[model samples]
Target: MASRSFKELSFVSIFFSTLATSYLFFPTVFANTHVISIISPLTLVVLDIQGDGFTAMEYVYSTVLFFATSIILFYVGITNFREERLFSEKPLTSRLADFVSAGVSRDHPHLSLFLLAGFTIPFVFMAQMLTLVLFFNIPMPLSLVLLTVSAAFIEEFAKSIGLYAVARERPGFLTPRNLLLAAVAIGSGFLVGEKLLLFATLAQITESIFGSVLFLSLQVLWMPLLLHITGVLITGGFLLLWGRQGYGPGLIAACTVHSLYNLHFLMGALL
Candidate 1:
């Protein structure tokens, strides 16, 4: 009976926490009935000054869409770990807590650490911005190639760095399942950060009329997100297979796969 009550309390706590986080991250979702896109300075630079806007409904939907996707991805990670019985014999709350704890003793990457990995997206974005600014004049084919390589290296390394650090702190974390879950958390974080940044960019630089349309369109798509998750999984898998040697090969392979995926889009954009 006490255990049942404890589990009920845990569920309630998680539910409320999720709601609070949602509001904190996207206060606009609950604030106004209507959302208007005004001409920001970035839009002025990147586009004509047009008064267009995304409705509050659209904004809310887009935000919810990404969060839902992130939740699903994170759940997949937990499910995978559970399939391996990583949390076997533990109470529900203990299992939940262990999954998010950063230490190896818990058998999973820390939840906070996963989120911090996601925040690294901005740093990767800045690097991308620098590459564009400095090398914009490069030939399209060459530039695409450079961008692909650069993006792959930077993103993979950024996403993997946290896992590597934690593993270093606790060598036992190098196990296959733990490594995989770590990658999942990092990838999920990357997706969240990337989507948030893209939305912000669209709001500021792209016209509201176009940005909202694009955001809505993307909400239905999962391929790009899946590719990112897969890339991280591969990187983590390599680390497990090759031990120390896996680091270089894993990074290179991740970058190559990631770049190839982007190259398809680049080719379409150019041609």
Candidate 2:
């Protein structure tokens, strides 16, 4: 089998990053930026944490924002996925039933169930990152390490769950790529929503619809999408390997890699 070239991965990374950066320059994005700082209504969570809060509140608020963004982005992503037929032909794990969750329409209960759970996995994982940093009083390096490990763990956990459930009941499943597909779908979905909401900060202040749209357009176009995509892709690979090596061994290896990735940032912070 041909290994994926670094060029291929780099291209994937650049493509998403560029798409996001493009929105910044559109003439109207300038106005949208003004609006958000001045006028947009803060979500309840954001509002609640706004003043005289503990330093930890900043982290907590960020965590809540992640959830809010993940919800919208994931929604937009799934909507786009359904329309685009975004499943891969290859399954990370040959055993994972790629068809079960995806076989039915977007409205299917099974699909919805998986979608909900898939999102929660990442949301919880990210929340844990902040929790570890703040409440647990772990050092920044340790928190970062835990964050990466948790991210990988969540991805693998979701895939294995999908694989087992689908392959067990369905025969000759329709697709072999459900787990990765769903995770990416959820991640991209999170990106879309987060882009708009976060960037909307500027546009909301201006109270101009046109500005709002451009802020969104610019926000939706890039890096966050790549981050979400790359992160999911790697996680999928780890999970596939885990399934092959036996669950315990696979989980440890995956988490270690993930931990190290986060440690890069965490250690710097600590130093």
Per lDDT, the best of the predicted structures is 1
Model 1 residue runs over 4 Å out of place are 1-110, 202-221
Best by TM-score: 1
lDDT of 2 at 53: 29
Model 1: per-residue Cα lDDT at residue 220: 35
Query: lDDT for each of the candidates?
Result: 0.54, 0.41
- Give candidate 2's error at residue 9 in angstroms: 46
**Candidate 2: segments with Cα more than 4 A from true spot:** 1-118, 121-130, 133-135, 139-144, 151-164, 167-171, 174-183, 190-251, 266-271
Cα lDDT tens digits for candidate 2, 170-197: 5333143755565566455545544444
C-alpha lDDT of residue 249 in model 1: 87
Cα lDDT for residue 54, model 1? 45
Clashing pairs in model 1, backbone N/Cα/C closer than 3 A: 37-53
lDDT at residue 130 of model 1 (Cα atoms): 36
